[model samples]
Target chain A: MAMKIGEGKFKENVNKNMEDTFMRGAVAGAQERLRTRRLDAAEELGNWEEWRSHGEEIRKHVLDNLDYYLHELAENLQKRGGHVFFAETADEATGYIREVVNANGGKKILKAKSMVTEEISLNQVLEQEGCKVIETDLGEYILQLDEHDPPSHIVAPALHKNKEQIRDVFSDKLDYKMTSKPEELALHARETLRQEFLTADIGITGCNFAIAESGSVGLVTNEGNAGLVSDLPKTQIAVMGMERIVPTFEEFEVLVGLLTRSAVGQKLTSYITALTGPREEGDADGPEEFHLVIVDNGRSKILGTEFQSVLQCIRCAACINVCPVYRHIGGHSYNSIYPGPIGAVLTPLLGGYDDFKDLPYASTLCAACTDACPVKIPLHELLHKHRQVIVEREGRAPISEKLAMKAFGLGAASNPMYAAGSKMAAAMMKPFTKNDRISSGPGPLKAWTEIREFPAPNKERFRDWFKQHEKGGGEQ
Target chain B: MKVTLFITCIVDMFQADVGKATVEVLERLGCDIKFPMGQVCCGQPAYNSGYVEESKDAMKKMITTFENAEIIVTPSGSCATMFKEYQRIFHNDPVWRPRAERLAVKTYELTEFIVHVLGVENIGAKLNGVATYHPSCHMTRLLGVKDAPMTLLQNVEGLRFEPLPNAHNCCGFGGTFSVKMGNISEQMVDEKVDSAEQTGADFLIGADGGCLMNIGGRIERRGKPIRVMHIAEVLNSR
Candidate 1:
């Protein structure tokens, strides 16, 4: 419910998540299922790489010409009698959304799954205004009922919770007895939310891709809640990050293909709903009054910068699913709603480094996120970029680390320094050596020694061995 | 073929056997091995930690060290990818960029060199045991050397290779990331070790030393009997 759910100290969060054996089992199972489904779907697509590349290209093209398309999108939406509001900050976006709700005299609001809304803390704002906001997405709804537990994943928000946890939450909150089977739980939620969907005054959803050509907004979901929310409500509001747009429907189709494949590993999700403007005559579904909220928040600053590639994210969370770090600690450890690789880069940018500085360093520079990314965001590089910014611009890097890296650069770049360092390493580690491995180490090595034995630096450096052999100083 | 061996710092010091095995394996495949005396650590340690200016010195040193070698091969996939990254690091230095590009053109991860460059899939090595391979993130994702190791491993006589669960996830050995963010790193490597053990592998194999060190160390701490071996060592096994 809060932006900083698992945002405590990273270690504490991991320890907590690790202790929850039930949650870990749930996460591991979900990951295995999703990973398999994704691969099968991609294989079915025949040219999955080409599709990924096309998706990346379209996203790049859009980010490159974002301003031009944004203006066009805004103007077109305004022409269709839809109100287009661009909020430059999170508070501004929340204030605008709240003002709209208050003006409409709306109290009960049903919401579709929208990460951007979460990023801006929109629900709390609406709550503060004495309005009830209900989440229609089953995962988010379960999280909401459990005393506003933070979403552990972007796509599968409640991935860390098992069916039993859900059953407990439902029983405690709704006072309904149900088995922990997924079918029974789904049936319970469906029965409960069906009425809220019908009676809701306003529907809020996140935009998957905003088509600039026709001034249309798109939402992709496995569950049909996003579509129902947009259709059944009298007043509809769609919140989107500015960069989540495509130049045309052709580009939209390309990205949508990539999103489904990369995120869920499917050719397409069950629903790919597109809504342009308010309902026209003869339209059986869709809201009568449409509001388009294009959120800049911190996106405009990322444009034309080294970190610009980050804006190309489609929020499919494929990168998160594949990340090894995310696999163990889960999403909440990121402390931001956008956990994982994409979250590591984007969250600190939006929320600032003070709260999210450590997020960037959470990666091992493994490049798994980059490879899995459908938009080719170069996520690992962006993480490195964050480290650079933290060190150079923010001046937040520790003095010891700075000094150590300075020494590393010097030693590694010069043969003499490297030789000297290598020569001394054996002696430097002399205190820890026993049977060629250090069971316990000092300083930085302590972390490593905590989990595994550290190999004591070898007494005979390879260069020394090689030098004697090259000069024929030793027999072959 | 003359192959220059970029013995990654870890292999040069902590795990010299991996480097030695790499050399013998390539030599057995009928390639001449050259150890450039001027070679040092790849700039990865500094670069990944955000010390660009510091890392560039080593980058420049590496460009010069293996500039003229006919083909550069390294025991570690991540370090080989570091050679490939030299061009990107030197994109602004016209002098180094072309030289870096030339180096990248010839650099290959050991198994990748054996399979893709040398055209040898089966090394005729025999290791009678069940094993699981951890696909190091840098090797598989960054260097894009996905199937070469598996291709070679499958052909090893008398060897049963189990696919590691969550094989693609990192073992949390991001150089200093292991030390800098120790807690999270431990958790990550723990999960990786668990996945490998889940495969019921007698030995856990990997192409990169950093990941091996992390996972192997944890397995030792936990007193897991699983043996950890480098892919080069496995390939060179006779």
Candidate 2:
């Protein structure tokens, strides 16, 4: 019900996910497809690097003047006859949303895919108040029907579910007999969701970027569910992270371009909805009352810090698409609503290191995330920063690791110690060495040797050989 | 050109043959090579694991060791990138920052030095075998030395180069990550080995010692019969 999805430890979650060949296969296939498409889209856009810089500049500018933009956005939204609430914590955000639902006597709410709401656990809170909450995005809908399965991926919530798995979930929950074809599954979900859209008393959506100049919330979707969720219900609520704001339409255009391309390799998604405030003066069907909930929930604390660059992220999942670790471990292994590289960096900041310390260490500092990032968050570097904090400030690293690292520092920094260590390494490892490889190594080598052979230490170190050869003992 | 070698600790101890090949290749190319005895580990294992202060001690040692070199070259891309990282590590210290920057500017990965500085691609080395190259992640992405190794490999006479599938993926050798998260690392290296096997290449060539050790160890354990060689060794082969 919370942002943190599973109860298992990070290792247990990874081991569990590693054993799920079905989920692993699905994730691998999706990663390959998305990675290729993202590359193609970047190439097609031409000057992707320039675009990335432009997007980074815009994001950095907005964050630099975030207070001004947030104030302007709220004032404009209020002028357009919308209620605006600033929730500092998850409980506050969900409580305010609950009050609105209770005041309106809302029984059933139709919701588009909104990660901020997921972060606040709004659905669980509303459902506890005896409201029927339905997820309208096809991915979310399938996940919802399967008994509140937390989204494995940020972009594609049900990415862990294959078509056959979806068919199974539908058959068990919805009593629908359908083949394992995407078209059929989508059509069934559409037919089912269409009824919920027509009958739901309220609609809730997540804002991609709130345009400050016009007080308009932008939503990008390929399925057009967000448009329906905002338009069909009489009372509409748009929830967004406090950091998700832009100064004007010009900045909004730039960010949206980066988001669509980096997230899904699209020039523009099928639907781009900008809802200013309720119906305005129009006669068309739209919400009469609109509310904007700006949820801080630990984001504002990240500002003016080493992690300020993390807020510049557009939730593209571009980093995740190329992450080699994510390819093996999958999204569920991250154990959060948000998963992969962004989640690894964010979950710790939002949830604290007690639950997410291992997340930072989950990476190899490959910098693939940094390279793929549209706004250039320097994600791998941020991951390293988390490690530094854990060791120096948090003092949460294992005592053994700390001692080992301290010894390493002494040995490596001093030439004599390094020379002695390298010299002794071969003789010390000789007992386990056979056929130029250590089959069963000692201490740290145990972990290495468990999965693969560790190369036996060279008895004659490279420097030794170099010294001998340079003296004309063998060559020349 | 006078070149100072930063033979990474991994190559110096575990893969001495890689270091030898590197030295022979560079010497044959008409360069006076020197090894700074004061140089030791790059401190990446500790630095990446979050001991920044402790790792800086080793980094400072490296900066001091190679302080007088006209050019510093390393057989491993990961270690060379670590030299570049020293500037950021000492960013707050004016004295160390400038010294680290100077060291960084002159440091080059082996293939990068060969193709860019020496202006030589084909070294006239010949080896007859089907091989796939694993572009180490740090070298390709962070150091931006994507084409240098390929350029040199392409010119290696009698060597049949097969493009490694999913070549952009890291081989699960994140130094300590290979041991710390061994379970997940196993799955990753397994995928890399499977992909290399799919290419039907008899040899797996890599630029970084860490990656070669990871993949090479796996090949030996699985008894896959695919030999692993460093790019330097492949280039020096005759």
What TM-score between 0 and 1 does chain B of candidate 2 receive?
Answer: 0.99
Per-residue alpha-carbon lDDT of candidate 1 for residues A1-476, written as tens digits (9 for 90 to 100):
44566536766776777677776667667777777777788888888788878888888888898889999998888788888999998888888889889888889999999999998899999999999999999999999998888888899999887778789999999987869999999998998899888889999999999988888899988889998999998899999999999888888888888888878888889999998989988878789999999998889998988989998888888888777777777787788888989999988887788888888998898887887787788999999999988987888989988998888888888888888888899899988888888988777887778767898888887666766755767323
DockQ of 2: 0.90
Comparing only chain B with the true structure, the TM-scores of all models are: 0.98, 0.99
C-alpha lDDT values of all predictions: 0.86, 0.92
- Tell me the lDDT of model 1 at A267: 84
The sequence of per-residue lDDT tens digits that candidate 2 reaches over residues B136-168 is 999999899999998999898888988888889
Clashing pairs in 2: none
Residue A182's lDDT within candidate 1 is 96
Model 2: lDDT of residue A456: 87
Candidate number with greatest lDDT = 2
Model 2, range A1-476, lDDT digits (tens) per residue?
Answer: 67899889999999988988888888888888988888898899899999999999998998999999999999999998999999999999999999998888899999988899999999999999999999998888988899998888889888888888899999998887979899998898889889889998999999999999999999999999999999998999999999899988888888888898888889899999999897867558789889999999999999999999999988889998888898878888888887889999999999999888999999989999999999989999999999999999999999999999999999999999999999999899889999888988667899999999998889889999989877868342
| Cα error, candidate 1, residue A8 (Å) | 2.6
